[model samples]
Every structure is written in structure tokens, then in C-alpha cells.
Target: MRVYLPATFNSLTELNESGVIHARSGWAFAVTDALREFYTSGDEEELSDVAFDQAALASLRLLAVGDVEKFPHRRVVVSADVDDAHVTPVPDNGESVVRLEPAAVELDDVAAIHVDVPDAEEATAKAVTAIDAADLGDEDAELTVGDAQDNWLAFYDPSELPVLIELL
Candidate 1:
């Protein structure tokens, strides 16, 4: 199964150095039965995009919990192909979140990483700080957060992890 794991630049840097990501029942996004039912009109590609979007939102939550200054303001998510047996579906009221048992992934398991570009830094920084307020329906915070999303993340092959970490 392909799972999208939310991450930060700090985590990515660690993965680049150690060639591994150690997670504990990690919260991730995947195409689940519920997701399929919710987006009944969506084709496979569309459903996958929805799953990826959920991962991006989850990354924002991860950013909100961490020291914002310790890493770039951008959201990062790693996509990997793991055995279906390792991924367990998580029940959520809204989005499709999953749990990866023994959530440790070697670099070899990673397929790609999606991250915001340098130009997104300023808006992303604002979004990182405004996440809570935005969730509470603060209009200003919502705008800031929305702007950050406008700076769409770019995908990079797993082989580019080293260079990406250096840039971060």
C-alpha cells in the first residue's frame, strides 16, 4: 500500500542522514474505503490526489506542534510504498487518515517527497503560526493559511533527499 506520511524539514534531514524514519503508529493518509465512498465520482487519480491533499493538511498540523523556527515553514510529506499488511486504516470523522504499524521506513521504501518551494517560505511561516486561529474561523488567519496553500508543494524523487536536506 502507498501511504503519505506527514513530515518536516527536520525530519527529512534526519531521514537523509540516517536513511530511515522512525515513527510510532504514525498518522498518515491513504486511499481508504471511506475515502472512496465519499468521492464517489472521483476516478483513481482524483482519489489519490485527495489522499495527498489530506496528507498536506496533516503536515500543517505537524508544523503547528513543532518549533516553527527549527525548520523551514513549508509542509513536507513523504510518499512510500509499504506492504499492505503494515498499513492499518484509521477511523476519522472527516478525512482518510491511516496508521502504519512499526512506522519505521527505510529510504529504500520511499517513492517521493512533496514539499513547498523557497518562494512559499514567507506565507508558510504565517500559516504555521496562524493554524490555530484559522481552525477557529479567524478570517485573517484563514487568508494567510489559504495563501500558503496557494504556493503548491513540488514533488521530488527519493534520490534527491540528500540535496533537499542540504537546501533545507
Candidate 2:
């Protein structure tokens, strides 16, 4: 099974140093049965993209939590293929929600990572502050968050992990 997990540069550094990283929230996204049923029409790739988007949004929510000022304000999504047995669905917890347990995501499982480009830092910072409001249905706040979400990303192969840990 393929999973898109939310991450940050700090976490990437941890993975580099330890050869493994765990999602702090235990939540990851994937194209599950619920996701397929919810989408009226789309190919497998399109469905996967939706799961990826959810993971990106989840990354934003993490940035908005406590100690917000301390975290680097950028979004990251780690794409990996893990054994199907490792993933468990979160019932009625939205289409893509899943738990990855025993929670250790080893470096070997990583396929690639997608991260916000350097130019999007300002917008991402702004979005971090507004995510809570956006969640509460504030239109203006939603737009701020949307701008960050729409920012282009840079893709990196897992082999570049060392360089990415430093550059990000």
C-alpha cells in the first residue's frame, strides 16, 4: 500500500540521522476504499492525488498547533510504499484517514518527498497563522491557507535525503 505522510524538514533530518521517522500524529493518507467510493469519477492516479492533498493539508494543521513559532513553516509530504498490514482505516474519519502503526517509517520505504519551494516560505508562514481560523470556516483565512497549498513544490528522490535534510 502507498501512503502519503505529513512531515517537516526537522523530521526529515531525524530520518536522515536515525534511518527512520514516525508521524507524530500517527495519521497518514491513502487511496482507501472510502476514497474511491466518494469520488464519482477518476483514475487511480487522480484518487491518489486527492489523498496526497489531504496529507498536505494535514501538514499545515500540524504547523498550526502549539509551539507554532518554533516550527519551520513549510509543507512536506512523504510518499512511501508499505505493507498493507501496516495500514488501518479510521472509520468515519474522512475518506483518506489511516493509521500507520508501530509508526516507524524507515528510510527504505520512502519513494520520494514533495516539499514547498523556497519562494513559498512567506505564504506558508501566513497560512500557518490562519489555519485554525480556516478550519473554523473563515473565508479570508481559507484563502490564505489556499495560497500556501497552491504554491509549487520541489520533488526529491529518497536518495537525496541527506542533501534535503540540510537544504530544507
Candidate 3:
């Protein structure tokens, strides 16, 4: 997944000097720890703890592969480390793309509540109700089985969630 960075942090060297990246709370700190490990590898004098921290923040956008441009905003640059960074682009007649595997399933053990609603013949009402009744809020939910037109299947675990309806 790609995230956009601000215009100010447009260069790797600049970010290195500054030392930090802005990102969502949960994930950014882990990335910071990894960055600290990278910058503090050599002699103490050669590394600047403060600088490294700034660089980590400046690298708001990171790719599993280091292509900064792939991120949505072009204003800020992609950040890469010299030692571990891959310099060469993978071969594709400019058509090759990086593929990300589905993340490991880490569903919480919340009790799952399943409710069945009267099926709607048309896709539109069924889809809207299915999406709304699920009431996922900010949580991740999937319409696993059917599409918007045919049928709707929304699954939520009650252990980590409240009641969720699977509209047919």
C-alpha cells in the first residue's frame, strides 16, 4: 500500500538530515524502530540519533520496494536506505508492477453475531442496507461471497465486534 507525503520532505538526503516520518499512530513507531536500527549500525560518532529520527519522520511514504514515485503525492520524495535499498528496477517493459500478498489473517476473537435480513431482489437496496447494517465504522469488513448486484455477505466477529448482518 502507498501513502502520500507532504511537499517539504522531497529528498532522501533532506529527510536524513531531519529524521522522521508522519504516519498513522499504530504503524509509524515500528517503522521508526527499524529506521533507528538502520542508521545506528556503525561507529557512534558517524551516526546522529537525532538526525536518524528526523529522517524516519520525513519518510512518510515507504514502499516495500523503494520506488517513491509510486506514492500518490509527488511533492514529497520516497525515502530509501543506501545499504539495503535496491537500486535496479525489476524488468518489465515498463509494465511490471510490484505485487503485495494478502496480509496474514489476524481476526480478533470477538463474538460474532449473524443476523439475516429479508433478501432484496434488486442489487441497489440490498447493497446499501447490507453495507449500512453491518455498521463496521472504521473496522475492516469484507463482502466475502457475493457482489453488490446478486447478494451481499458481510461478516463481522462479535468477539471483536457487535452484531453484524449478512443480507441475502
TM-score of 1: 0.90
lDDT winner: 2
Model 2: lDDT to the true structure:
0.86
Candidate 2 C-alpha lDDT tens digits along 59-139: 887777643333468788899899999999885888999999868899999998888887998999999899999989999
The order of the candidates by TM-score, greatest first, is 2, 1, 3
Pairs with backbone N, CA or C atoms under 3 Å apart (clashes), candidate 1: none
Candidate 1: where are CA atoms >4 Å away? 68-70
TM-score per candidate, chains pooled: 0.90, 0.94, 0.15
Candidate 1 residue lDDT tens string, 1-168 = 888887887778778889987542477788888888887698877888888877786677778887345565888888889898988787664557888887888899999999988888798888888989999999999899888877778999999988877776
Ranking 1 against 2 by TM-score, winner: 2
Best model number under TM-score: 2
lDDT ranking from best to worst? 2, 1, 3
Worst 10 residues of 1 by lDDT: 64-73
Ten-residue region with minimum lDDT total, candidate 2: 63-72
- lDDT per model, in order? 0.81, 0.86, 0.26
Backbone clash tally (model 1): 0
Off by over 4 Å in 3: 1-102, 109-168
At residue 82, give the lDDT of candidate 3.
23
